[model samples]
Target: MMLSLFDQFMSPTFLGVPLIVLALTLPWLLFPIPSNRWLNNRFLTLQTWFIYRFVRQLFLPMHRSGHKWAVLLTSLMLFLITLNMLGLLPYSFTPTTQLSLNLGLAAPLWLATVLIGVRGQLVYSLAHLVPEGTPTLLIPVLVIIETISLLIRPLALGVRLTANLTAGHLLIQLISTATFVLVTTMPLVSFFTATLLVLLTILEIAVAMIQAYVFVLLLSLYLQENV
Candidate 1:
């Protein structure tokens, strides 16, 4: 039987058990644990360097209060990038493509930032609902607009990730399918299509990494507003 294009986004199952848990946990296994010795392999050294640079750059603009989030944000960035890159492999499932999983990740973190803002500076947080030097007539309208925008942050985060990944995957599948069909009917055209497919694959790889970074970077910005 022919499969639907969206079938790739569905969670795989075996023996009546869903494999999403395995997919989510698999990326961590690929990472090497820190060694006790001062010296380490090239791979470990590179990984450490990448993480150090990412954390330093990410937190450079934030206040000291936001420094505590370095570990959480760094881990999140690694987790997301791993899942995204791994999904590019043949026969692999991408959990982030699922809206539920993406929302699950976005909601709590976004809520935490809002809560932190309220707890630390309720007046400042509430002040965000109303901009400075606003006209009396527009005050209520602006407040409503700002509140809606504030509430939409998590939804935007989840949808942005899901839509981007889903679109890229669908495009790749469509092009590959077209290339396969053309291979037998039109060898010359198929060769060119296959070349296009390779370029698209490289673009998708960049998209995967970027989307992961953008996801976490937005979270940090939200935290910056609060902390």
Candidate 2:
């Protein structure tokens, strides 16, 4: 019968297995592995160039020590963007839309950066909890506030990704349902709604890529501070 809009966000299952397992693994297979040949196919060439540019831009603001995270961050970006774009297609699930998945990805990486900061520069990391010119009475309060903010970064990262994707998907589903309902009784209105859907779809595609970039970019910024 009828499906709720939120139903689309549920992780699908086949037999006893979750399809999310496949969704998460599928993106990596879509990429072509680099061959030993001196020349590569156009797709591989373009892929390599795009990744090179992205890594260069992402790491430009960080110290040399932060460069070690290049591979992890780049892979994460591609993984996220692919998961997001794939979900836009018919009959596919987006793992990134799940809060648990997003937090699973965010928490450890964010923790790693914090740990690195603690390990490398403990005093500096502690200093971040308080500003230099804090009034005598406010130092403890500022430290507590800053501590809470620091702890919330990973939660914020996960929620930001989840909220953005969920909102876009819901909007798309709602508009498509309206367009479908209007097609019989109000063809002209349906046409305009359909056009709007097309434009939103395009915007969603850009949002998919941008959200992925923002996720990794913020992580890199955190790393830069630590390094």
Candidate 3:
């Protein structure tokens, strides 16, 4: 029986239970726990520095009101980066590659930011649906358009993350399969393909990290608008 290229994406199960739960939980264990001692090891120091810098840059433009989300956003960045990077490993399933999971993460956070804007500054929030200096005839049309755009934010977030990771993984798998097949009949060509595959894998690793940052960064931008 031939397996589909996409079979790699199927959620793994054992005894009828989804292994995604384990996949999701396992990454968290890899992070070093902070120790009680005042001094920290190099790894812990580096982790702390990265988090501090990321949080600072992410919220720099927003008012102090947005600062409250620093921890949530920072934690999300780490969670997503971990998931994305780990998925590159052989035989591992990536939960974030699922649109359902991505939407589940995006929708609630996007809605919360919208709700905060509505509750804290209802007039301002509603004002965003219509632009300043619009002609009278275009006001209603512009409002509807803006409202649709606002509603699509979460969908865009989910789709962007899902699509990028899916494409990268699919490409990697296709190239790898080709490399293995060519090794038997075309050793010379297979050598070059293998080299390309190695480079591609390195690129995928970078993409995984960047896509995670982009996801979190966009969320912070949405929060900035509200707060």
In candidate 3, stretches whose alpha carbon ends up further than 4 angstroms from where it belongs are none
Per residue, candidate 3 scores C-alpha lDDT tens digits across 1-227 of: 33887777789999999999998898789999999999999999999999999998999898999899999999899999999999999878989999999999999999999999988988988988888888999999999999999999999999999999999999998888899999999999999999999999999999999999999999998888888
Rank by TM-score (best first): 1, 2, 3
lDDT score, residue 180, model 3?
94
Clash count, candidate 2 = 0
The lDDT of model 1 is 0.95
Model-by-model lDDT, in order? 0.95, 0.95, 0.92
Clashes of each: 0, 0, 0
lDDT of 1 by residue, 29-146 (tens): 9999989999999999999999999999999999999999999999999999999999999989999999999999999999999999999999999999999999999999999999
Q: Return the TM-score for each candidate structure.
A: 0.98, 0.98, 0.97
Name the runs in model 2 displaced over 4 angstroms: none
Weakest lDDT window of 10 consecutive positions for candidate 1? 1-10
